[model samples]
Target: MSSRIIAAAVAVAAGLALAVGGAATLVSLARPDRGIDLQNAPAGNGVDGGVVDYGTK
Candidate 1:
């Protein structure tokens, strides 16, 4: 009986830890813009910018 109780407690703790970690990961990924805001980003011109530039000018 005592061994069963200890096993149950350990299982519950492990499940709670997994749930919290998963929630944290999802929350960190909640923002779409965040995925783009990396420290070292690429510097490239827009693909359709030439069309807009000539048209507007």
Candidate 2:
């Protein structure tokens, strides 16, 4: 086959791969099942008392 034909085939394959990947990402984002409760996330100053302890300094 000619170089032009091979190049076109490669471009088409790459485009299809990108399209499939983007579609999958969108679908997964649309329907999350991790059960994580982001709205009720723990506060930084809650029982943990923040992530850093400045008293050591």
Q: Candidate 2 — what's its lDDT?
A: 0.82
Give per-residue CA lDDT, model 2, range 1-57, as digits (tens). Answer: 699999999999999999999999999888845566676676765467656456774
- Computed on alpha carbons, the lDDT of every model, listed in order, comes to 0.79, 0.82
After superposing candidate 1, which stretches have Cα over 4 Å from the reference?
31-57
> Residue 54's C-alpha lDDT in candidate 2?
68
lDDT digits (tens) for residues 7-57 of candidate 1: 999999999999999999999978668556875455458733433245553
Per-residue lDDT for 23 in model 1? 97
Give the CA lDDT, 0 to 100, for residue 48 in model 1. Answer: 35
Per-model TM-score on C-alpha atoms: 0.44, 0.47
User: Which stretch of 10 consecutive residues in model 1 shows the poorest summed lDDT?
Assistant: 48-57
Alpha carbon deviation, residue 50, candidate 2 (Å):
43
